[model samples]
Target: MRPKIYLFGDSITEMSFEHGGWGASLVNHFNRTVDVVLRGYSGYNTRWGLKVLDKVFAGSSESESVLAVTVFFGANDASVEDRCSAFQHVPIEEYKQNLHSIVSFLKGRWPTTEVILISPPPIDEPTRLLCPFTENKSGLPERTNEAAGNYAKACLAVAAECGVSAIDLWTRMQQIPGWQTACLSDGLHLTQTGNKIVFEEVVEALKKKGFSLETLPVDLPVIFDIDPNDPLKSFQGI
Candidate 1:
């Protein structure tokens, strides 16, 4: 069976196969070596993600072939509880618990499958104020970097506890000079450059786990490997 990379996260993950998305970038990078599967849901938090975990993995039990799974919920979980988007607000503690549940579940099911936890990217507060999640007359953003930082930290803690890998997107993105505008499109979503950062980071993390594109075994031959005299010969038994 072919090796697979599962991306389980929120809207940012859901749209990862778009033209310049990070998921698509992975697909491009891996080519025929490994398949990148998308199980992303829009506007989901760790709470909802936890509830649906079984539904996504129950039908697929090919544990050995499962290379890695990225758990990337939290942007929605960081929502302000008293705000209009409070429906998605999960307390920081609960968020950590939910993340722990997710990592534990994946590792339990796929014993060798690497679980990479990606914290939500930094929020662009001023832009969010101008374009709130909903029409909040309070003139406030539903999410903020400070609020999301708690969840991001919680994510890193969970990874450390679980002894797995993690990407501290919130902190990493903010470290850039103009990250507020450079990384996020509005307040939450990622721009092309932002997606590029995510793609690069994932590649680096996977490389550390010994899963680089150069190291992964290729499934089929490239065009150059196909013999001009007998093109079908290469694929007959593959």
Candidate 2:
């Protein structure tokens, strides 16, 4: 296959709607430079991804031609279980363990892979209210800056521990003015515009680390068939 960058994550990663997902936006922003392989699955946690790593990897080979791998997760893991479902407020330790497993699995399977860990951003309270399921989950409250920060820190620590590149989108999202309003339509998910903001920041960070769009093939197809309801879809128009 042409050079590919596989994206592994939850709904946020899979989000490719009409306007486009973060992945699509990422592709458009760098279309002149790189092509992408989308593998983001909705409602999946790091724990579950570990179980399906083989399937994920089976889609691509470990050849040097593969450009990179980006993993974006944690929103669903932090979600609160409601009405008998696994909740978001995953204990910090469990979250850490789950992430550790994912990282280890990646390293073991592709020792030479260029891995990137992207921390999920803080949720907007009103955005949370927009989703009835999330609203009903009392234990899983809207994401506070502190909680979001903690999660980012944990993710960063894990990435460092594993010696991989880390993208701290949480802090960048929080620093923006009217971030809550511009970033999220509800409390937890991003709006279309919000996703653009995310894609831009992530691309900038990647560029800083010497990842240029000029490195990948241009004929690779873009994956934009994302579900609008997906958490990552909130960033649809953005």
Candidate 3:
């Protein structure tokens, strides 16, 4: 069975297969080496994510092991409680607990699977206000950079406590001058540049945890090495 890497999160993850998306980048990077399983639910927070964890993971068997799992959420969870999108709001304390629970649950099911937590990217309030999705809506830009930063710190804390890796996108994105205009498209979703940043950070984090495609055996034979009349020979060992 092929090794698997699961990307679990909210809309950020769900939309990651789009052209130039971070998830797509990973898919291409690990092509033919591992299966990239996307379990993203648009607009979901950690609380909602935990409710469906079992359905998504379904525990790995001895024959099929999960190589890594990236738990990326918080964008929706950071929604202001009194805002228009309050339905997706999760309390700060609960957010932290939920992240811990997610890590613990996944670890229990697949002890060897690497867990990488990704905090929500920074939000651009002005751009969000101008976005058609939020332009005429009340309580516009329901999320703030500060609120997202808090969640990002919480996510990092959870990773440290669980001995896993984390990508603090909230903090990292802001470090880039004028990231507000260059990274996110609607203050919430990522643009191509934002996706590229995420893809690079995720790759670096995975490498630090010893996940390297260079060491992983390809799932199929190189096309050039396969004989047209004797294809089985190239796949003999596999």
Candidate 4:
């Protein structure tokens, strides 16, 4: 059976297959070797995400192996309760617990599936203010770098406790000079450069776990190798 990689997260993940997006980059990198499954739900937090995990993941076949599963969320969960977008707000403690639950559940379901938790990226409050989503006057941006950092730390902690890999995007993005201007298009969403960062980091993490795209067998014979006279030869070992 073909190997699969699952991307599960919020809007950042939902839009990951767009032009110059991370998910699309992975699809290109893996090519015919693996299947990239997108299970992103825009505007959904860990609270809602946890509830729908079963619906989204359902069941896996014994013959089907999942190479990796990326759990990316916490952007909307970091929403300030008192801010305009309180609907997406999830308490920090609850957010951490939910992440633990998610990792545990996925591990239980897919014993061999590698889990990679990605922390939400930093928020640019000033740039976010310009977004129509935060039009009305409010105390602070619906989300803040500080608040998202807190969630990012919690996410990392959960990953450690759950024995899973993690990508600390919050801290990494900030380390990049002029990240505020280059990494994010608006205040929260990733720019093309930011998506490249994610794609590279994820690839690095998978490599560390011994998942090398170069080592995987091609899913089928190359089109150029398929002889028109004997097309069945192309599918012989597939």
Best by lDDT: 4
lDDT score, candidate 2, position 40: 82
Candidate 3's residue-wise lDDT over 154-227, tens digit each? 88998899999999999888888889878888888988999999999988988887777877778778898899
Residue 221, candidate 1: Cα error in Å is 1.7
How far does residue 24 in candidate 4 sit from its true spot (Å)?
0.5
Give the candidate order by descending lDDT. 4, 1, 3, 2
**Model 1 whole-model lDDT (C-alpha atoms):** 0.90
Residues 1-238 of candidate 4: C-alpha lDDT, one tens digit per residue: 5799999999999999889999999999988888999999999999999999888887555457888999999999999898888899999999999999999888887888899999999999998888736454864688889999999999999999999999999999998888997899998999999999999999999999988777777776888888999989778765
Put down candidate 1 lDDT per residue, 49-157, tens digits, no spaces.
9999999787678545899999998999999999878999999999999999998899888889989999999888889887776778877788887989988989999
Top candidate (TM-score): 1
Q: Which residue runs of candidate 4 sit more than 4 Å off their true CA positions? A: 59-63, 132-135, 223-238
Please give the lDDT score at residue 76 for candidate 1. Answer: 96
68, model 3: CA deviation in Å?
0.5
List TM-score per model, in order.
Answer: 0.94, 0.78, 0.91, 0.92
Candidate 1 global TM-score: 0.94
Checking candidate 3 for backbone clashes, the offending pairs are none
Task: Give the C-alpha miss distance for residue 101 in model 3, angstroms.
Answer: 0.7
Please list the residue runs of candidate 3 whose C-alpha ends up more than 4 Å from where it truly belongs after superposition.
59-63, 132-140, 224-233
TM-score-sorted candidate list, best first: 1, 4, 3, 2
- TM-score, cand. 2: 0.78
Off by over 4 Å in 2: 16-20, 80-89, 134-145, 214-238
Please report, in order, the local distance difference test score of every candidate based on alpha carbons.
Answer: 0.90, 0.69, 0.87, 0.91
